[model samples]
Target: MKVIAVANQKGGCGKTTTAINLAACLGKKEQRVLLLDLDPQGHCSLGFGVFNEDARDLYDVFTGEAVLEDIILPDVFTGVDVVPATKTLQAAENLPVRRDERDRLLAKYLMPIRDRYDYVVIDCPPSMGLLCFNALAAADLVLIPIEMSLFGMHGIDRMYDVVRELRERHGRDIPVRVLPTLVDSRTRLCRQFLREIGERFADDVLPVMVQFTVRLKEAARQGLPVIAFDPTSTVAVQYGRLANETMSMLQDDAATDGVGEPATGLPEATAAVQHNNPANEAVPVLQSHATPGGMEESRKRLGTMKRVFEEARSRLSRQGGLQKVVLRFYDFTGRDVKLAGSFNDWRPDQGVVTRTANGIVEKIVMLMPGTYQYRLVVDGLWQEDPSNPEQVSNYSGGYNSVLQVEEEHATEHA
Candidate 1:
C-alpha cells in the first residue's frame, strides 16, 4: 500500500483539511483509501462525519489496548475507511516511555492491513511527539502543509533534519513533498512567496495551488471536506486534481519496482508495447465541454471575473491593510532544502541555501493579518524554527514556524 503522512508542525495550516478532502476525492475515483486520525483534536475524524466521543482510536492501537481492525470505521464516502481519534489521544505524549518499541508502533499496526487499501493517509497532530514519529516511521511519503509567511520559512529546516535522521537511522527512506495551503493569489506578497518557492525548489514542487476560499471554512464547520460538501467549488476541484496527481505518482512508482509489478504478461517483446498503445497515440483531439457558440463567451466571462478579483485585491493591499512577505533562503549545509507549509504548493523548492557569505542564510516575507506555520530548507531539509520562543512542535518531534498578525490589519482588509 502507498502510505502518506499529512504532517505540519504548525496548527491550522490545513493539514487535516487536505487529508480529508484528498482522501474523499480519491475514494470517489474508486480507490480504497484508509485515513488515520492521529491527532488528539480529531478534526479529521469529524471531517469524515464520524463522531464517537469514546471511540477506540489511534491512542488505543498505539498503546496496545486495541487492534487496528477494531478501530477502523467505514466513512460516509465510499471506498474510504477511517481510524478515528478521541480525546484520550492527548495522553499519547507519554506513550514512548511506556512502550519498548514506541517508534515502530504505528508501522507494526499498519503492516498487517497494508494490502487491504490502495492508499493510507495519516492525519498527524500538530506537535512533534511520539505519535508524529510513529506516523513518519510508517509512511512511505510525507506531505507538509506550510503557511506562507516569514515564520513559516523558519520552521522547515528543522523538519528536514528530522526526516533525514529517520531515513538514515531507521532505514526508512520516505519521499516528502511540501504543499502550499490557503493561498490568496491576489496578494502580491503571496504571489512573490510562491515565485520564490518555485525558484528554490524547482521540480520538487507540485503545479497546483490550493487557493484560500470561504467554501473551505464552510466545509470545516459542517464537518465535511470541501469535495463532499460542495463538489462544484474551486477548492473541491483543486483537491480532486491533487488526488489524481497523487494516484498517478503512486502508479508510476509501482510500475518502476518501487512497489511490485503486476502479475500479467502474455507477450515478452514489442507486441506488448504495441498492445498498450492504440491509433490515438499519433493523433491529437480537442475535447470541449462548452457549446460552440458559447465557448468564447464563457472565456470572456471568466477573464472578467479574474480581473475583478485582482482589481479589488490590489486596492485592498495598497490601502495598507495587507503587506506582502517574501522568504528567501540559501542553504549552507550543501544539501537541498524544501519549504513546505500552507503557503507554497507543498512541493520541495531550492529555498535551500547551499552557499552563504556570512555563515547565515535569510528569507524576508510580507504577511497580512493572520497566523501561519512554516519550516526551513536546509541541505535538502525540512525543519522548524529554533529561534522563536512561541514555536510549537509536531507529533514527529519537528518544530513549526509560527506568525501572529495584528487584528486591526485584518479588519482593515475586510
Candidate 2:
C-alpha cells in the first residue's frame, strides 16, 4: 500500500481537513483506505465523529499492548477504515524503543497489513516530534497543505530540511507535493500569493487548490466529509479532483520504480493498478476533473460558489452608507486595470468600477469614510498603486497602496 502522510508543522493549515477528505474521496474511488490519526489532538477522529475518550490507539500498538489491526475501526466510511487516535496517543512519543528503530516502528508494524489496503493516509501531528518523524519516515508521499497567508507559509523551509535528512537516512526518495488550501481566488492578495507560491515551488505545487468555504466548517461540525455532507458542493468537487490527481501521481511513481520526476501536468492516460485482493477490482483512475475533458463540468460546479460569494459581498457592502472615491492610474492606458481593496473585502470584482480615458485609467470604489489598503491588478498582475504615495506593508514581504477617505471630501479623487 502507498502511504501518504499529510504533514505540516504549522497549525491552522488545513492539515487534518485534507487528510480526512482525501481519504473519503479515495474511498469513493473504490480503493481500500486506512485513515491513521497520529495527531495527539485526535482531531482527525473528531472530524469523522469517532473520537472516543477510551479507545485502543496507536500508543497501545507502540507499547506492544495491542497490534495494528486490533484497533482498526472498520468501514467508518465506504471502503475506508480508521485507526482512531485518543489523547493517550501522546504517550507513544515517549516510548522506550531504541533511537534508530523508533522512527521505523510505524513502517515495521504496517508491513503485515500493507496488502490489505490500497492506501494508508496518515494525519500527522502539528509538531516535529517522534510521532511526526515516524509518519515522515514511513511516508511514500508527503502532502503539505499550505494556507494562503504569510504565517501559513512559515516553517516550510524547516520541513524541507527534515525531509532531506530522512531521505538520506532511509536511502530512498520521498516525493513531496504542496496543496494550497483555503484559497480565495477572487482576492488580489490571494491571487498574488498563489502566483508567488507557483514561482517559488514550481513543479512541487499541485494543480488542484482547495477554495475557502463555510460549508467545510459545517461538514466538520456534522462529523462528515464534505462529500457525504454535500456531494455537489464545489469543495467536494475539489477534493474529488485531489483524489484523482493523487492516484495518477502514485501510478506514475510506480511506473518509474518510485523515483518519478515531479509531475508538471496531468497524465494523458492512466494504467489500471492490480490489487492483491481477489474481490477488489482493478483501479483505473482519471486525471483531475478540470484538467481533462471536464472544463465545462467544473464551470458548472463553480457557478454556485461564485453566486454565494457575490451575495455575501453585497450584503456586507450594504451595511453602511457608501461614498464614491475615484482612483487614477496615469501610466497604464491600454492595459486592463481593476481595483481590489479592504473596502470591497479584497475581491477585485466586488465594489470596484473602472473607466479608461486618454493615457489614464480610473477606478472608482464606493466605501464608508475610513482608511483602506488597495492594490491594482494590471493585466492580471498585482501591484501597489504607483500614483498613490502612501503605502503600508502587507506582511507578506510586500506593500499595499494606502488611501484615507473622509466624509468632507469623499467624492473627490485621491
Candidate 3:
C-alpha cells in the first residue's frame, strides 16, 4: 500500500481539509482508502460525522492497550475506513519510548496491517512533535498543503527544511508535494503566488489548486466531505482530481523504487518484516499498483513540466451582478455537453451546454468578474474548449480552458 502524510507545522493551511477530502474522493473512485487521524484536536473524526467518546484512539494502540486492527472504523464512507483520534491523544507529547527510538512507535504498528488498503493517509497535528515524527517515519510521501497567502512560501520553506533534516537524521527517504490550498484567483496576489510556488517547487508542486469556498466549511460542519455534501461544487472536483494525481504519484514511485521502499529509520523491523506475529500475518500480502519501470517515465514527464498557467480570455461582456459569457463548442456533436471547471465545482450536469441556432454547442455562463478554468464533458469525454486558445495543465495529467469574466464597464472601457 502507498502511504501519504498530510502535514504542516502552521495550522489552517488546509492540511486536514486536504487529507479528509482526498481520502473521501479516492474512496469514491473504488480505491480502498484508510485515514489515520493523528491530530489531538480530532477534527478529522468530527468532519466525517464520526464520534466515539469511549472509543480507543491512537494513544491506546501506542500504549499497548489495543491493536490497530481493533480500532479501524470500516466503511465510514463508501470504500473508506478510519482510525479516529480523540482529545486524549494530546498526551503523546509526554509519552516516552521504552528504547531511545522515539519515532518508531507508529511505524511499528502500521507495518503489519498497511497492506490491507490501497492508500493510508495520515492527518498530522500542526506541530513538530512526536506525532509528526511518527507520521514522517511511516509515510511514503509527505504532502505539504499551503494556504494561498503571502506567508505561504515561508512556511513551506521551513517544512521542507524539516523534512530534509529528518530524512538525514532518521535515514528515511520520502517524497514531498507542495499543494496550493484555498486559492482565490480573482486577486492578482493569488495568481502571482501560484506562479511563484510552481516556479519554486518545480515538479514537487502539485498542479491542482484547492479554491477557497464556504461550501467546504459548510460540508465539514455538516459532518461530510464537500463531495458528499455537494458533489456539484468545484471544490469537490478539485479534491477528486488531487486524489487521482496522488495515486499517479504513488504508481510512479512504486515503479522507480521497485522492491517497495521500506519504512525508513526502523532497521530491525524492515529486516524481519516477513516474520511478524501470527495474528498480524492475516493481513494480506502487499501488492503495488504500478507496472515495472513506469515510475521513471512518469517522473521524467513530471519533472519536465513548467508552471504554464492558463491565461483567461474575455469574449463577451458582463451584466449587472454577474459577467455573462456564451461558450460556443464548434466541433462537438455529442448528445450532451456538460461544463465542469473551477467555476462550477466541476459538475458538468449543473451547467449544461445547449445546442444553439448557430449549429454548435453553446451556453451562457453568468459568473462574477474573475478568472476560472473549465472543461467540456462531451459524451462523457473531458475535452478542453477547442476554440479557446488559452489553456493550462491541470497537474493531474490533463488540461483546462482558462476563462476571464469582465464587467460590462471594464470591457467597454477596454
Candidate 4:
C-alpha cells in the first residue's frame, strides 16, 4: 500500500481537510484507504464524526499498551478506516527511545499493517516535532498542501530540507508533491501567487488545485467530507482529480523503482497561467525541463491540462469581472435562510445561506463594483443584515441592507 502523509508546517492550508476528503474520494473509487490522524487535535476523526473521548488512540500503541490494529475504527466512512488520535498522543514525543529509533517509531508500527489497504493517508500536525518526523519517516509520498498566499510559502525550504534529511537517514527516496489549496483564480493576488508557486516549486507542484469555496467549511460543520456532502461541488471534483493524480504518481514511482528514474506523471515546471489583463486568456508558463524521450507523455499531459484550464477560463469569462461580497447574519436558528438582492434579480432561490463553524450564517455572492440592496429571508421572514449597519428604507415597512462593493474591496472571505 502507498502511504501518503498530508503535511505542511503552515496552519489553515487545508492539510487535514485534504486528508479527510482525499481519503473519502479514494474510497469512492473502491480503493481501501486507512486514514491515520497524527494531529493531536483529532480534527480528522471529528471530520468523520468518529471522535471518541474514551477511545484508545496511537498513544496507547506508542507506550506498548496496544497494537496498531487495536485502535483502528473500522468503516468510519465507506471503505475508509481511521486510526484516531487524541490530545494524549502528544505525550508520545517524550517517550524515551534511542536516537537512531525515535523517528522510525511510526514506520516500525506500520510494518504489520502495510498491506491491509490500498492507501494510507496521514493527517500530520503543523509543528516540526517528533510526530511530524515520525510521519515523514514512514511516508512513501509526502503531499504538501500550500495555500496560495505570501505567508503560506514560509518554511517551505525548511520543509524541503527535512524531507532531504529523512531521505538520507532512512535510505528511502520519498517523493514530495505540492498541492495548492484554497485558490481563488479570479483574484489578481491569487493568480499572481499561483504563477509564482508554479515557477518556484515547478518540479513538485501538482496540476490540480483546490479552489476557495465556503461549501468546504459548511461540510466540515456537518461532519462529512466534501464529496459525501455534495459530490457535484467544484471542490469535490478537484479533490477527485487530486486522488487520481496521486494514484498515477504512486503507480509510476512503483514501476520505476529499480530503474532509477523519476516519475513522469508529474509535469515539471509547466503551469497553466490564468490572466485577466487580456481578459480570459490562458498562458502557459514555459520551463527548460523538457527531455528528448520517455518524458514525452509529460508534455502531452501538460497540454491536456492547459486545454482543461482554458475551458475553465472560458467559463469564467462570462462571470469574470465580479468581486466577492460576503453577507453575514448572526443568531440565525432557522431551517433555511437565503439572500435575495438586485444582484441576482432579487431571487432567493439563487443564493443559499451557509452556516460556518462559528455559527455565523453567511452568503457569498459575486457582484461588480456598485451599490446594491439586499435582504435575508430567514425561514420565511425577511430581515436586514444585523452585522451591516448600512441600510436604506424599502417600499415596505422594514429596511433593505445596502452593500457597496468596490474594486479595492476585492477581499474574498471564502
* Predicted structure with the largest TM-score when compared to the true one: 1
For all candidates in order, the CA lDDT equals: 0.64, 0.74, 0.70, 0.73
How many clashing residue pairs appear in each of the predictions shown? 64, 0, 2, 0
In candidate 3, stretches whose alpha carbon ends up further than 4 angstroms from where it belongs are 98-100, 170-172, 255-414
lDDT of 2 by residue, 158-224 (tens): 6787887767676566777888998987876467557656645545677777999999999999999
Q: Model 1 over residues 127-204: C-alpha lDDT tens digits? A: 667788778777666778766543344345556667765565564355666677778877776665565455333333
Worst 10 residues of 1 by lDDT: 270-279
Please provide TM-scores, in order, for all candidate models, with all chains considered together.
Answer: 0.65, 0.63, 0.62, 0.64
lDDT for model 2 comes to 0.74
lDDT of 4 by residue, 1-414 (tens): 778999986666899999999999999989999999998889999999888877788889988999999999999898999999898886765677788787778877887887788888999976666778888877777899987743456557667878877666655577788888989889766786676666566656777789899999999888899999999998998898888878767766563221122234432222222111212112343121433334465567445544544444445436565566776656775457788875554678473345465766667775555456677777887888776786544423366676777764664332
Residue 180 of model 1, lDDT score:
72
lDDT tens readout by residue for model 3, 1-414 = 877899976557788898999999999989999999998788888889997777788999988999999999999997889999988887775676754466668877876775788888899986666788778767778899977753344345556766775566666566787788879988775776676566456556666778899999999999899899999898998888888778876876562221143445632211111221212222121111223235575465334322222122121122154455677766656467788865555677564435455557677665555456678887889988777786554323356677766645332111
Alpha-carbon shift of residue 313 in model 4 (angstroms): 27
TM-score of candidate 2 against the unseen true structure: 0.63
Least accurate stretch of 10 residues (summed lDDT) in model 4?
Answer: 272-281
